[model samples]
Target: MVDQQWTGVRRRVVALGARADSGQVFGSLGHRWVLEDPLSAAELAELEAQTGARLPEDYRDFLTGVGAGGAGPAYGLFPVRRVQGRWRWEGDGAELADPSMLARPFPGHGPDPESLAALLAERPEEEDFDASEEFDDAVEAWDERWEAVMFAPERTAGAIVISHVGCAQREWLIVSGAHRGTIWSDCRADDTDLAPLVDDDGRPLTFAGWYTTWLEAAELTSRQ
Candidate 1:
């Protein structure tokens, strides 16, 4: 049986595409309002088997009911595909998600706050250096330390990159641990830690809630 959660989602998206001007929305041009094919039961099974983890219910249903990807928030949903019998998601920085580690629990927090603060305090400022070359070298070394703390692979375990909002900003869907099924924002590129995407009430957004909310907003924008 098709998952009822996604029953009218595809139709709604298609209808929006027909009327909505893509240019009106940011990152719409990436997908052009197109949806890729849904995954079959066998394919989904194969994917889960390979990854050693079951995807969150809402996202699993989305793969079977809606499309595997396309026409979503930001630059659209990253498409998952089987290449040479290996399932992987495709998009800018999508490879950051390690399929082998999907079963691990996601670390809800990034680096220690005190340590992060110290590192930020130590960030190199060009104006502090007399020579441009010295400043460049100092900044580059500082960036390495920043990336080490912010972009550590273990920080994102059990999550998948879902969407990109440009400038290296992306979003993740937690597939394991207590936060499973919720969406989280990735702004490490801007020297920020990952955070849960919350509703106006500050409740973490589940996969269904996140997508439906975006769909509703897109519909509203289209009608305007």
Candidate 2:
């Protein structure tokens, strides 16, 4: 249980306006991601052990390669490297950033009364409450993390991603964006295996979009 302090690497979030492919996104927003280093070698090692989950090759390469201690290049909405310290968080050719726009839960998705009732019915333990709170705080810390919601998304994706990442005993899903409706990861496999998404025969994939083929989210706390 070593608490290793990771390098304060920078991940910039720039804003965008239009969808590059469509060439039209006036009232839209996007971002440009950049990963900066000067990180601690020890932190990387500690992260590997703490997560107990190996990062993908592309992700790993992005961290420990030529960009290990400096700004790299940009890749898609998430630039692998950049030339600045602040993340591109504005309207570009892709989209833009708006905290007020995402202050609510989901865009069209409101609070699930049924879900809330179910939660209140079950009095979770102190640890459960603590974990949930932590998850929530982390989600609020980042906007682009909204790729974990299928509901109103852009408004709640960040929260959902936090829940998934901070979950100590449940499966999680990750989408491409707030409303992309894709799959990311299923923490609770048949046993306790934690691998990326796969096909029918077990071939790895770049991404799985969004899906609910995993465990029931609400059930995570009550199960234990």
Please name the candidate that would achieve the greatest lDDT relative to the true structure. 1
Q: Relative to the unseen true structure, what is the C-alpha lDDT of residue 143 in candidate 1, on a scale of 0 to 100? A: 93
Best by TM-score: 1
Model 2, 182: alpha-carbon shift in Å? 12
Per-prediction count of colliding residue pairs?
Answer: 0, 34
Task: Encode model 2's per-residue lDDT on 54-101: one tens digit a residue.
Answer: 433333443453233212111122222222532122212112222233
Give me candidate 1's TM-score against the actual structure: 0.97
Error (Å) of candidate 1 at residue 28 is: 1.3
For model 1, the stretches where C-alpha displacement exceeds 4 angstroms are: none
- Which segments of model 2 are wrong by more than 4 Å? 1-29, 38-40, 66-204, 207-224
Q: Please write out the lDDT profile of model 1 over residues 1-224, one tens digit for every residue.
A: 66797998988878777773746766788878888899999999999999998999999999989999998998899999999979999999899889888999998988889999999999988789999999999999999989887888899999999999899999999998889999999999899999999998999999889998988888777767
Model 2's alpha-carbon lDDT is 0.29
C-alpha lDDT (0 to 100) for residue 160 of candidate 2: 20
